[model samples]
Structure formats: structure tokens, C-alpha cells
Target: MAAFDELDPLSGRKVLVENNLTFHDVTEAVAAPIEIPNARWWGFFIVSVMMLGLLLVSLGWLFWEGVGIWGLNNPVDWGWAIVNFVFWVGIGHAGTLISAVLFLFRQKWRTSINRAAEAMTIFAVICALLFPTVHTGRPWFIYWPLPIPNQMGMWPNFRSPLLWDVFAVSTYFTVSLLFWYVGLIPDLATMRDRAKTTTRKIAYGIFSLGWRGSTRHWQHYEKAYLILAGLATPLVLSVHTIVSFDFAVSQLPGWHTTIFPPYFVAGAIFSGFGMVLTLLVPLRSWFKLENLVTIKHLENMAKIILVTGTMVGYAYGMEFFIAWYSGNPYEQFAFANRAFGDYWWAYWIMISCNVISPQLFWFKAIRRSPLLLFIISIFVNIGMWFERFVITVTSLHHDFLPSSWDYYSPTFWDMTTLIGSFGLFFTLFCLFVRFLPTIAMAEVKSVMPQADPHFGEDGHHE
Candidate 1:
């Protein structure tokens, strides 16, 4: 390992040079000062504490009072709970998508945000799990959905979308956590070195698994990460497609469309990118990482959002066109009634937020502006929620019989539970930011132009 002592051509000054540092150097740099405070931190703590209390209270009530207290009835049995489940799960997709897919593409910007984004993925999956787990009424017996034979000799339905969701989501969460944690090991080792207290050192030491910055370790680590990324790309698409199948597999008129898979995948990426932007924009600024993360990273993400948004819009059009072409009066009536019927307001909001609002990003100015990007990200989340609502409630509310048609609304408990999920999300994210290296510093440093000084000989960097 040699230091570059040559004069610089760009600035005509001596280049600052040192022994070439490994990934360990970069990881330590980012993890060293990660404990800074922002207003969002206090807000996150307060909100999370309150939400935790609410979650405890709500769980107690659900157990004591029974599932009857929920707004679910025969026709609309799957209401706010299911909607929020899909919403949060969709939120979970953004993180792994940003980390794994972008890694595969060699997108350098992903390094700045992927660590936190992947952590968010894990937390969002946790929140998503609560819905189905608790909503089962007999939460304990929920395991009957697994393949194990019970005393009654009944097995879980392999054909059921619910079962598919169980396998898909569970596998997705497990793999994503593994990928995220594996990526964090080298960084955790860096933290261990910088740990102020024995406790911190021990904790990070255990997490780091005694990682040493040997060339052999880096070789194995890089290979493992690439394989994990390959595993995750399909998992990302499969999880959401299975989620869509939870609707599409049903015989319900509006829900029976074949276009749901691609549509749902696009919407997942759209919403996922939105959630990533929402987290990173404030995070980069608050952490004083302007030079490291950079505006160009956010701009790249906005372009992704734009592409995904357009795909969602195309899906919407395809759904409409196919509904008309299918010649099923039930399907036709379902789409029409969704737009112009009782829940028309919800439908329009979905359109405006998801389909219309994102089109503004076509302008480079809006795409690059952090403030506008933040606002659009919020819109994307809102629109995604409405998209799930429109798919679930709208289709189910108006089935074949006119008499069975009804409206769905979130009750008091429903509202609390949804908000409480947000608390859970932020709490996990805030803890991750405070404790772990928020940026994948090793990966970022690897891509920086100055990381390799051989550029003068090969002229590859210029």
C-alpha cells in the first residue's frame, strides 16, 4: 500500500495522501458521529412512546372485547386492517428495492441511503406483520395456517392467497433482515472500535462477529452481498405480487383482474421510492451529510419515482381498458362505480395523489428540489393507501347483488392502530439511525472518485 505524493493537476496542489484505507476506514468515519440530534428525533421519540402505549391498550382491548369491536362485518370483513397491512408491506418494499436492486445496477448513490433504507424495510415488515397476526381473532391459533397437521387433522390451504402471503412475507422479511444485517457487520466492527463504553463495544462486537478488515473477509463479504442482492430482487417482486394475489385471486368482480400483479409491483416501487425519499431528504440535511449523500442522490431517486409513477398510471389505464374489453358487466360496473359512485371521493383522491400529482416530477426543478420531493413523497404514500383502499373496499363494497353493496369506514380503533403502526415504524427507524451507521459508508467510499488514486495513470475517473 503506497501513498500518492504526486502534485494534483486539477487544483495544481499536492494531493492529500495516506496509506490506502480499507472499507473499515470509511465505515468508521460515518459511524463515529452518528449520534447527533434533530427535531425529528424528539418528535419521533414522543410519537413512538405514545403509539407504543396505544398499541398495548389496543391489543388488550382486542383480546378483552373480541374482534366484534372492529368495523368488520360480513360483506366488508376485510377493512382498514387489511388495507393498512398491504400499505405497510408496500412501504417495506422500498428499502430492499433501493438497496438490492440499485446495488445490482451499480448505482453509486444508493450507498448513502441503502443502510437506513434496508433497516426501514425490516421495521416496516414488522409493522405489516401485526395486522394479520392480531386480526385473526384467535391470534394464537393463527399458526394453523402452516403446514403442520393439527389435532383435527386439518392442514392449511396451499391454494389460499393468505397462505401464499404468509410464506412470501415471511421469506422476504427473513432474507431482507439477513441482507441488511450482513451488510452492517463491517460497519458494526467500525463502531466497535469507536465505542466509548465497554457495553457499546461488547454489543457492537457481538453484532460485528469479530470482523477483521482482511482481504479474505472482504472477498467473502462482497460475494455474499451480491448473491443476497440477486435473491432479493425476485423476492421484492414476489412479495407484492402475492399481496396483489390476495385480491386478484378472489372472484370479486373488481378484484379478479389479471393486471394486478404488474400494477401492484409498479405501485410498490412507486410508494417504496417515495418512502425512501421521505426518510432520506430530512435525514441527509439533519445529519449534515450534504457532501456525502449529495443532492444528486435524491435527484436519482426522484427519477425512479417518476418512472414508477408512470408505470402505475399505465397500470390504471390497463385496468380500465381491460375492464371495458372483458365485457364483464360486473367488472365494468365496479370500475365505474368506484369513480362516480359513493366512494368516488376516495377514488379521485387516489387518482390525484398517485396518478396526477407525481407527473409534476417531469420537471427537473421539482425533481431536484428537496422540499418539493418531500411533499411528493407524502403524496405518493397517501395515494398508495388510497390505491389499496380503492382495490379492497371499493370492489368488495359493491359485489354482484345491489342489496349487498355497502360502504366501509375506519372506526376509532382502526385509526389508532394505523397511527400506532407509524409510531412503530419511526421508533425502529430512529433507533437504527441513533445506533447504527445510517449510511453504507464503506460502499460510498468505494465509489468516490478520490478513493482510488490510479486515475492519473488509467484516466478512468476523469
Candidate 2:
């Protein structure tokens, strides 16, 4: 072995010994020209158009008539709208967490997934914001939820959970969108350079904001990014915590639990990872991004899903144990009713989808297989929806009074709105895919072995 002084600092080639074998770092892995199956992009485009049309139609209907056209009523007034709101907000968490938290941890592997994940974060937050405002019944007076001057001398209820949600969600969206657009600047410059038409070049050039890859610019850029990521890390945690408070702060038997804050955070990550997997697994293959985003990245993501799913399962177990131990009859009965009551099917579906489905990832074969991961991701999504349903409707349907007890199922309008939300999500995503870089070229380049001269042989110096 060469002594430290004898070795070149410029070529600090350190061998990675894994599984009793040595490996050398090579040139940066350049993403090959993507030759994705034509059908995939076309299919996504078609589906997005259809969904966009549906979303416009639904929004028009909701705007024209009012919230009353839906099934919301007294006692059950916080119906599917709030559930969908929380669900979409939860879905938003994983993106920022992956981008900010993982970046702080110096997880170099995050390069492939972080770009698209951040975009999803922005779009998911947009989907989430629609609910509470529209659910207000008087959609025009949605500003009443904000801290603003009004005709009345009254201030909005500062103590209200919904009020906290308004602040938290808005703050979260602002920060997330900022972080995402900041990251996109370099990539947008790349698109601007590669543009073939005057329109495309001008559009991308403006968005790129005259980025020139200057060392000084990068110095400030990196500093700004670090500060933004630091801000986002805490905000990501707080956003979902406040969302959970919308339920936990309530006196409802099933909703009232101390574990909800962290439990909601974990579930948010779980479901958000599920959505990421659903989008990426298809996208990587469809876009022929195999060299850019390899199987190792997918496997790592699967591992996270497995870990979060287990935590979710443990939370479920704790809720049951605590309900019984608290000696509160209402709490115990609520949990018991969840497992084996009229809506027991929804409860079991939640358990099976969230808990059982993720277990398949323990098998390396399943985790590595894109198709299998895609299927599991869908199951996780379904399970998460039911998890919200089990928490909201199950708790609200049969409350403290037996006389007020009633079964709740979504009406046609409710289903239409739900479907339209999917359309909205996909519509935004499709637009992003067509226009945006999709991959973080600058970030990916930074992580490449070639970027670090110490890792390659040719850069050797004494």
C-alpha cells in the first residue's frame, strides 16, 4: 500500500470493497439518448387531455351551482372533501422530504428521483388547496379563512384548526414551489440551449433566467439551495403535523389520539412514496431512463416504503392497544368497531393494502421488478385512501349518540369530483413531463464519479 504522503491528493482514488471485492470508480455515467416507446408518451398525453377536460367540467359545475350539489350534510359536514384534502397533502410530503432531508444527509443517490419528486410536491399541494376553499360552501368568501381586512370588524378564529391549516398549507406550498423552481433553473438553461424553434428557445430562455453556469452564480446558488432545503425540512414535518391536527385536535373518538402527529407524518411518507413509485417506475422505463435512474434507486425507494409501511403498521397496533388501555369506553368501542363493524371491509382493506402489500418488498425479486413495484404502489395508494376513510367516516358515522348514527357513502357528484382530482393530478404531471427536464442534469453531473477527480485514475498526481 502507498503511504498517504506518496499518494496524490488530486487523485485520491479510494477503492470500495464490497462483498470481498474491490471496485474502481469510472467516468461519469452519461444518460444515453432517451428512446422511449412512442406509445407511452402518446398514451400519457391522451389520458391527460381527457382528465384535464373532466377536471375543467367538474370545477365549472362546482363553481356554477355550489358545494350543496355534493353530499355534505350536518354532523358529516367534514366528508370526503376533507379526507381528500388530507390525503393529497399527505401525498405531497414525500417529495420535499426526499429532496431536502436526503440532500442534507448527503445521499448522492437522490439525484435521479429528486427533480420529478419536487415537481410532484408542487402539483400535489395545488390539488390539496382546492378542497378546504371549495368545502367552505361560500367559495367566494374563501378569503375569510385568511388574516385579512373584511367588512366585518371580526378577525378569523385564530384558535381554529382550520385556520392553522390555512397558514401551514399556504406556507408549505410557497416554500416547495420556490425550492422546485430554483432547482429547475439549470435544467431549463439546458433545454434553452437544446431548443430547435424560436418559440421553444424563447420560452425556455426566459424561464432559465440567463443562467450561465458561472462559478460565482453556482456559489450563491448552492448557498441559497442549502438555506431553502433547511427551511423545507422543518416545514415538511410541520405541514403534515398541522394537517393531522385537523383531526387529532377534535374530540372524536377515533380521531383523538396522541400518536396522530408522528403517525400522520409516517403515513404521509408512506403514501407519498407510493405515489412516487407509481409515477417513476413507469416513467423510467417509458422514457428509457435506465442509465439515468437505475434499479438500485428503485430498490432503495422500495426499502423506504417497507420501513414506513412497518411504522404505519406499528402505529395501527399502538392505536388499538392504547384505546383498550385508556379505559375509555368510546375509544375502545371505536377501534373495535373499525375492525369488525359495518364498514369492517374498508378497515380490512386499509390494513391489507398498507401493511400486507408492502411485505412483498422483502423479497428482493419483487422489489427489483418494476411491474411488481408498480402494482404494490397502487395497493398502497388504495390503502391510504381507505385509511383516511376509516379514520374520517368510521369515526363520524357512529358517534357518541346512537340516534344520530348513519352509514355514509359518496354520491355520484362526490365520485365525479374524486375522479376529476386524478385528472387534475395527471394533467399537471403530463405538462411537466413535456416541458421540464424531468432529470436534474446539474445535480446528476455533480454526483458522477467524473466530477470528483480524486476518484479516477487519469487525474492521478503526486
Candidate 3:
């Protein structure tokens, strides 16, 4: 309620375009944070920077000590590092979903939030990359993936899922980056045109590629964006599928299931939208973007979370049934261990967060209540992380060899490194909103009615 005061002017209407905001107002609202960030923005920025500092310090310590500083043992050699990598990667999925899939389907509501979601995808991928890089321990020689000769001159096993990850993740990052940057060109041009300082003008101009908003420019922009969306849509499915391959191809009982690909994809979008909700709810409130990022927009995203969450829950249930049906005792134990064994806490937390909490969206009021929506989003994020933890650690810790079984516990460095990734993500995001327009000003304009277009006063738009 405190942050969403801007919505009061709309009375009781629900539309993609709200409050009769002029194009000037749209551009100015988004640009204002970049031009003159307030104290609250500074507070968030500084906190994120501090977390980024933690990341650097922890990474430095990790580099000095090696992966041994982590709580990796014979049973759980793959620890939070892999879990964090998948978690971050999954978080990035919602961006492409919003930017590409929805756009391809002509969902105009995406216009208001796609820019920030796209930025979030980029930042989330950056964080995802950090874990696997450092997880190698000898990150300096990480270039072994290149076709060139290394110290040993032995080529990496191309069959390795790790290698697949190298290609899958790199491709995802490259395409997502290009997609995000292409979308920014017009907005960068707007900033350049608005610039009062020569330095700012030059900086924005260089990136904007001399975008003149001409008919030809718009035509080319639309074509390039469409092509990139086509490219990115499949990457959304493939990237996470490949990431799941890191487990699915393994002989481990819990990981070897065929269900992992679609399951992880569903979970990824589930968590991705959860993160989008977490960030945007507060952002729209803080920046007074309620008109642009309307309740309907939030509700649409909530519906996605609802659908995906249900898909994820179904996948969870099917995994248990598949295990039992296989008549493989090891597989049976793997699923049972997840629920009733050492990691039961993580399993139930995942269930509550990913499965149960999203059910609240069935109630219209809950989806529309920003505070309630934000709260559930937090749960969804927490639950998704626990889901990854359960999937990674539970299966590994209690594998076939009972003698090798050991409880996994993260060391201080491990915890710090995991927490620090958030710092990197938020720091990038803080800088993004502080410099770039958070909302797509150009796209939002297309949705707004120029005529006396207050929502049909009869409440039909709702």
C-alpha cells in the first residue's frame, strides 16, 4: 500500500495502459531514476555494492584456498556451487519468456516490464556463470574448453555434460546479451537525445548506433528484434534442458530420470517469474510505475507462476511414481531419502514454496494484493532454491554406497560465495535501473490510447 499509492488515481480500472499517462510522463518516469536517483535508490545500490564486495573477497579467498574450502566430500562433491549455478540459470529464464515468447504471441502487456526483465536475465546469467567458473577450482585454466592446446594438451571430453554446459550456457549468454542490447538501442537514443552533458551524449550515442527513429530504423529494428526473439525462445528451452543434462546424464538414481528436462524447464520459469514479481512489485511501487506496470500485468505474471508452479508440482509427484514404478531399489531409495531422510527439511520446503504457496493465486484478491503477491514471491524464490538443494545434495549425499554417505554442510567460504552472487546480481541491477530506462518507454506508447481513454468507466476493461 505504501509504495503503490500511484495506483489510487485510476479508481477501479484494470488495463495495460492506466492513469492517462502521456508519453513524456512515461519517458521521464523511467529516465528520472537514471538522471537523479533518490536516497532510497542509493541505499539499495550501496547494499548491493557491499554484497558485490563480499563476492570479490570470498572469490579471492576461494581462489587462494581452492574448492577444498567448500564442504565437498566423497558423497556430496557437488555442493552449493552446482545448485547455485542452476538456481541462477533458472532465475534468468523468465526474462526471455517475457521478452521473446510473450512478444511472439503479441502480448502487449509485456511492453511495460520487458526491459527490466531482460536486464534481469542478463544479470542472472552473469551470476550463474560465476559458480561454474570458480567451481572448477583451477579457474585460470578454465580456457581448456577452447579447442587450443592446454598444458597437458589433452582435449576435454566433449561427451562431458560440463562441456555441454560450456556451449549451452555460452550460447545462451551471447544470444540473451544481443537480444537485450538490441532492445536498448532505441531507449539509448532517447537518452542520448535528452542528454545535457557532452560526455553523456557521446556515451549514449555510441551505443545507440545513431538511431534516428525513422521509418527505416523502426522497420529494421522490428525485423532484428523478431529474428532474435525466434532465436532466444528455443534457447530458453535448450539452456535449462542442457543444464538439467548435467544431472540427467549421470548414472545417479535421482538424476537419471527422463523427467528432468521438462521438469527443470517448468521449475525455471516458475522461479523466473517469481523473481520478476519480487523485483517488479517493489520497483513499480518505488518508481511510481503502477500505471505502466499495472495490476493486470502483475496478475498475468502471477497466473504464469501459478501454471508453472503446478507443472513443477506435478513433475515432483511423477518423479516419485516413476521411481517406484521402475522397481529400482536405488531409485526408490533416492526419492524416499529426499522426503524422509536427511534432507527432508529441504524437500518439504521446496514443496511448500513451489507447490503449495502458488495455489494462493487461485484467489483473485491474493494475486491483486501487491503485498501478498510480494510475500508469496519470496516464498517461491526460497522454495525454488531448496528444490535445487534437494535435487543436488539429497541425491548425491546418499547414493548407492552407504559407506560413502555423509551429511553435506556448507563451509563459511561456501556460504559467503553463494550469498555474494546475489550481491553481483543486485549490483548489476542497481546500476541498470540507475542508468538505463527500466520500462520499455517506446513499446509502452503503442498500448496507450491517445483519445479520452480513461478505462471504460463502466468497468468493462477489468
Candidate 4:
């Protein structure tokens, strides 16, 4: 087992994983929270439920009163609901990137963070779905966007970007859920085997599908996982690309741009990683998982934030440059209005938080500091939200006609609903962290030399 000590190939330093951890240690550490609930877990859980209740209350009032309760008006019909929709959808991308794209590239570091990231992806999508459902003001009619047959004889407009979003998001969520659950089966089986009580054993056994850890079962699991990863990699790109289409395909001056697909995808990854860091920083310490989710892992994620943040900043500049270069008066005015109009503050907030703050990661000290990284990640989240706000509100507020130009502000219901969405996200995340393996224990073990048959007893390659 000593021969299994992970080493950084570049600097030859010991890697982030603890050298002495065994397979049993991984199982016990991951399963402990499930078998035993602590005060801290319950404390967070209760808070999340309260927030979720707020969401329910807000929605109930929204349904009872109507969409008129929102601050939406003639020019700005989108308001905060669309802004939040885009924000939450963008935040889901990082998990798919980590779980699928990185897996296809054979990046071993993903093992430490992929489980939580995938779970975040699923939860974020759930939150994202909520806004559009409620935005329709008739949650019961939500299925109208789907291609199902109806008595009205009107099928969904296949050419509509909104319809594209319906298909894209649903497909992404389904694939992500399957990918996440498939990965969990082996770990669930491990829990089932280790369960002390019959109820626990039976519950886990059902979800585990009676996994026996046989060589053939592993072969099938690996094949299915690889296939899903292959399928999901394209989805990681397509889901957000289609999402950007909701804006880019429109005739709207600020949104209709060739650069949106790549730009939105980059911003999605940036925000997603920010959220991953924000959640994991506290989680690592809370669960005493510092040894597994090492500073190197944190550093790697920060580096990603730096790179994507730069890309997003460049996109910001490019949008302005193109607006000016195109010589289209509407586009030019739209970009200028964003920078110097009524919502100018929001534009600057987006720039400062998304572009400037992420630059701090260039410092090795900051990248390695969990506290600073966590703080910066929160800033990135705020900035990304503001970015959506600036794009959605600023563009629509001052379109072509001055008569249609109107100021947009979220009502109390809007504010509460948005906050409630966070509650929904955190509730799901808390449940995931509590019951499931926060880390991919099987994958982590597979990366260790101790799991390799070819390694010699003398701590040398055979």
C-alpha cells in the first residue's frame, strides 16, 4: 500500500491524497454521514427547508395573484425571472464539464470532485427549471411547450428557440441524472454491504440493484459509464449553446450575436466552477475531507476559474467591439446603454466581480487559499447573476421606441422566489452530501497504485 502513494508528476511532490487511506477507510468516511446524522447537518437542512418553504409561499402567491405582481412591463417582459433562469442554467454546466468532458479526457483529478459536481448539476437544473415554469404564470400549462399531442391541435413550434430550450434542458437533465445514478450504484452497494441495520441494508440494496462487485459487473459498469460520458460531453456543449440560442436567435440587438454560444458556454463553466468552489470549500472542512480534496484540487479549480473568467471578460470586450464595428445604430446604442445607461451599475458590477475579482487567482497564494478562493467564488456568483441582469434588463429596457422604454425592478415576490430557488438548490445539495458518497470512492481507489495488480511488492513497477 505504501507503493500506492500518489505523486505529482510535474514537481514529484506527494499528491493531495492521503498516503495511508485504504478502501475501507474511503467507504467508512463517505458512509458515516448517512449512518449518523449530526447537529450541523440538521442545522443546514432546516435552513434549506425554510428557504424552500419561502419558494412555495412565493409561488403560491404568484399563482393566486398572477404575473402582474412582478415588476415586468412593456419593454422589459423578461425581468429577473429570465435572468435567474439563465443564471441557474449556466451554473449547471460545470458539473457536466467535470463529470463528462474531463472523464472523456481521462483527467484523474475529477475523481475527487465529480460526484458533488454532478449532483450540483442536477440540482442546479432543477432550480433553473423552476423559473420558466413559474414565469408562465400557469404551472399547469407547463407541458404546452413539449411535443405531446393536445386537443388544440397545435404542436409546439419546432423552430422556436424556447422550444429548443425545452428539449435541450430536458435531455441534459435526463442524461445527467442517469450518469450520476449509474456512478452511484457501486458505492451504494458498498454502503449496503456495510449497513448495520436491516432497513439500511434493504434500502441501499434496492438502489444498488444488488451489485456484487464481481469482475463482470465492473466491466459492465465501466462500459456504461464510458458510454454515458461520451454522450454527455456533447450535451455539456449543446445544452448551453441551445440556451444561448434563446437570446442569439432573437432579433434583439444585444442578444443576437454570433459569439453567444461560446461566450455563454464559457460563462456557464466559469459560474459553475465558482459555485463548486463555494460549496466544496465549506464541505471539505466540515466533513474533514481536506486530505482527499486537497489544496491541489482547489488550485486546479481556481486555475479553471481564472482561464474561463478571462474568456468571459474577452467576450465582454468583443461584444462591445462588434457592436461598435458593425455600425448598426441599434446594436451600438444597446452596448453603450449597457455601459452608461440606467442599469450601468449592474454592468460594472458584472465586470468587477466576474472579470476583476477572478484575476486574484493569478497569485499562487490566493489560488491555494481556500478562504480567499471561497470568497472570490461568491463574488463570481454575484457577478454572473448581475451579468444576466445587465444582459436581459439593459437590452430590453431601451429598445427601439422610447414609448416602450420602461424601468424594470423585481417585486418582493421576485426577490423571494429567487432566494427560494437557492433554498431549493441547497436542500437537494444537503441531502446529497448527507446520504450519498460526496466523493467517488471507487474511482478514487482505482487511481491508487494499491489497486493495480502490476505494481511489485518492492514499491516498483513490475
Residue 116's lDDT within candidate 3 is: 93
Query: How high is each candidate's TM-score?
Result: 0.92, 0.91, 0.94, 0.96
Worst 10 residues of 4 by lDDT: 1-10
Q: Give lDDT per model, in order.
A: 0.83, 0.82, 0.89, 0.90
Q: By TM-score, who's the top model here?
A: 4
Segments of candidate 1 deviating more than 4 angstroms: 1-29, 36-40, 458-462
lDDT per residue (tens digit) for residues 1-462 in model 1: 012233445545432222344455555456655644557677878878788778778878988887777787667889888898999899888898888898899776688788888888899899999999989888988788888867899888798999999999999999999999898887788788888889888999999999988989899889999999999999999999999999889899889888889889889888988998888888877776655555667777888888889999998888889889999887899889888888999999999999898999889788778899999999999999999988888887877777876777777888888888888888888888888898876677776546666655654544
Task: Please tell me which model should have the higher lDDT, number 3 or number 4.
Answer: 4
Superposition TM-score, candidate 2 onto the true structure = 0.91
Task: Kindly report which residue stretches of model 2 are placed more than 4 angstroms away from their true locations once superposed.
Answer: 1-39, 455-462
lDDT of 4 by residue, 1-462 (tens): 132346754446556467467777877766776678789999999999999999999999999999999999999998888899999999999999999999999888889899999999999999999999999988899999987888999998898999999999999989999999999998998888888999888889899998888998889889999999999988889989998999999999999999999999999999999999999999999998876888888889999999999999999999999999999988999999999999989999999999999999999889888999999999999999999999899989998889878888888989999999999999999999887889988988887656767654564553
Model 3 is weakest, by summed lDDT over 10 consecutive residues, at 1-10
- Give the lDDT ranking, best first: 4, 3, 1, 2
The numbered model that scores best in lDDT is 4
lDDT of 2 by residue, 1-462 (tens): 112212223434321111121111111122222212255666877887787677678778878888777776555767889888988999999899889999999887787789889888888889889888777767888888777877787799999887999999999999999899999898788778777779878998999999999999999999999999899999999998999999999999999898999999999999999999999998877665665566667778999999999999999999999999999999999999989987999999999999999999999888878889999999999999989989998898888889888787777778777777887888888877766767787887676554565655673632
Q: What is the lDDT of residue 413 in candidate 1?
A: 86
lDDT for residue 167 in candidate 3, whole number 0-100: 94
